[model samples]
Target: MPVNPPPAPTLSGDLLTIHRLLQSPAQIQRRLRTIQDMRFIADQVLTQRYRSAGGAVLYEVSEPIFNTRPIEAVSPGSEYPKDVTAEGAAALAAVSKWGQATRLTDERIKRNARPGNELDRVLRKVVNTVIKHIDTITMSAVASAVTATQAAGDDWVASTATILRDIELAVADIEDLQMGYRPDTIVMSNTKYAYLASDEKIANLRQRETRDNPVYGGEVEVIGGLVVVKAPLSVLPSDDVWILDSMQLGGMADEAEVDPGYTVAEMAVQVQSERLARQDGWEVWGRRITVPVIQEPAAGIKITGTNPA
Candidate 1:
């Protein structure tokens, strides 16, 4: 029996199979872009260019008054009303660069059975890191833009009456600003969304829509005419829900031609695999350039204490 030991098991076949699972170059790039697109806050706001002449600082212009006077029928000789005075101001916003990089050793690349696109994985990591940083910055800006906050009590599900009232109040506050803006989007943490989806009141309302309709499946409820969405806890606090006029939020990015520009659309991952004299690995890195600004704070409201027990 000792002399009958079989030959050692070969791993080449398994390795080859695993190599086949590596995605093509196009697939890799598409996946990365898809991930970035999924960032809800980034997709919702307005994005503008930061021109090179703007320098490292950009200004947000504001006009406090648009002087509107009621029109009156003028007598034939009455002097036409004078044009209203124009008052304008700007707030300075400093732009900063954010970047992440990763290196893959030559040996590791050679050992990879799927070798042609070895650097794709490294670039993906860099892209993901940059997107996360952008999201964090945008979320922080949103939190700061909150002009009003309401307490939703311990449970929105149990306190349905209060919840509706609070939502209405939040919407009313935005309307009271008279800024020609309305709250059209409601964002909340995933935990809060789950609770709301399961609440008896919400379920009953959606029952008609979900009846025997595959396309209208799940809870399709709108509160106070605002479309509700679930966001990660990192973006919105688990204990709060935010109602915002998304149009009022502005984001800026620099173009590629701009010096020290930081714009997500212009963001790219650079790869260096050849001409390495000492290093034996491929270097991959990406940068994110952005300035998240609250163009109108009065357009957004945050509701707190909504966490379910």
Candidate 2:
């Protein structure tokens, strides 16, 4: 916490011009630091992440595809065991940079009757845009990183008989391939999740299994051995449901160095302000250097057409 925070510039009397805000590098940096401390679904779904800039995303194509192997009985004199190599070949995917920058004009700043409040709003939205963009990349990676698709035999929204079965089928779809990954998580839209909560069977189970049901408690717990992630419509703008082993789903590659006590995503952003070379105002720039990659596609399965038609 800052002892004496930067004063909010007023339109009149203590007029705070855009130049004043830009001049305070410490204040601008402090604000960005706090903003960088934020988190999103990309942070959760992409469980593997670290700080590193260059080089390709080296990963296993299929990974350990053999779920079970034959064991041989051996005498004291017999050989110990056979050696086995990991399934799939080594592949490389270049990490691409993703960033966005917004310029602040003095004319625009002057129009803002409440410069202090509006400036804060501007900075928040600017950084959030970049973060959301990163989240979208990861969502797209996982959504497309599936070779198996489980179409609901019955509409999940209306039919109760196959709701749980649908999830298991998606899980098995991945496990049956012997890909050495078991899905323990499911991601869906809030609308679809509401239907799951309203299911009579699920409601009864919640009622009998625990006195403090998630239904009445206003929270969702584990269901059918899978952690439920009801994502926002904007984040998951699809009718398709995803069940995956997040531990093996994908990872993020960061180009910026993370400072101690700060997240890689936070440190990935660099914010600075400089006088407009030709203009009368300052130009505030925000950039994030990071990328998300799906290392193993077989670790996930997509369940399509789960929403009501």
Candidate 3:
């Protein structure tokens, strides 16, 4: 059976104000996830190429095939073998918009109003929600590429004796794929990060001098050649650790004109505002667009069952 559609928003009052905040020139300040570790492909690249090719729906990539034909001793009448290249295509799918809305009641707004910027507080909340949604989507895409061997039973924290061993194993898995990928980054939940930082073996390997500020006081940034990143439990489970050749993980955005791609769009927030005449309040809504894809799944591994000390 088909699912029922959500009821439409009641559009009785005139739109008091509409801020295409995304298209605006003013800088809106808010905390956002650090997504520099991932790669991003622009929609314009795909769209332009598709249009150039008579508006094809799919963008195709062709790779040369080599070393398949064995060289044989030439006979006077023998014919040389022929080799061909392989090709694959990725179709562009519409990334649905994710949005959220909050109603600002008159009483609530008046209670929290400031001298000049009465609406700043409520607007910031809406913007932050949009940013969080983008982060969730990007992280989920990265997590999806995790390999099966790294799951639950092979817990690195549970077996303290094998913590370093597990790290090696995880890196080996990426290298073994022969995809020319090297694991340079490791991300784990805050809990697991604490466990690793306190582990006796891990502490000994830390360099005496520090180049970057520690997440937890005295926590080393690098472990086994991988830069360690502590992620919130909301982004990754406390029991899981992810090792990645970040160059292979990427993000996508829809916009006009073509330029270099970004791992995550520097800006992904847009806002629309409405005045609620009936409730003597206001409504704020926001939306963002992003598509995260792993160009090479072999470059990432996820290990679970880690103890969150």
Lowest-sum lDDT 10-residue window in model 3:
41-50
Best TM-score among the predictions, by candidate number: 2
lDDT of 1 by residue, 152-256 (tens): 645675645356667777888778878777688887767776676666654454446336422345453466698876667775434578888776645554424
| Model 2 superposed RMSD (Cα) | 5.3
lDDT-based ranking, best first? 2, 1, 3
CA lDDT of each candidate? 0.59, 0.68, 0.53
Report residue 174 deviation for candidate 2 (angstroms): 3.3
lDDT of 3 by residue, 160-268 (tens): 4567678888888778776577787887767777677766766566555664425345566788898777666775423478887765543343332222221223454
lDDT for residue 152 in candidate 1, whole number 0-100: 69
Error of 1 at 284 (Å): 0.8
Top candidate, metric lDDT: 2
Ranking by TM-score: 2, 1, 3
Backbone clash numbers for all candidates listed: 1, 0, 2
Sliding window of 10 residues with minimal summed lDDT for model 1 = 266-275
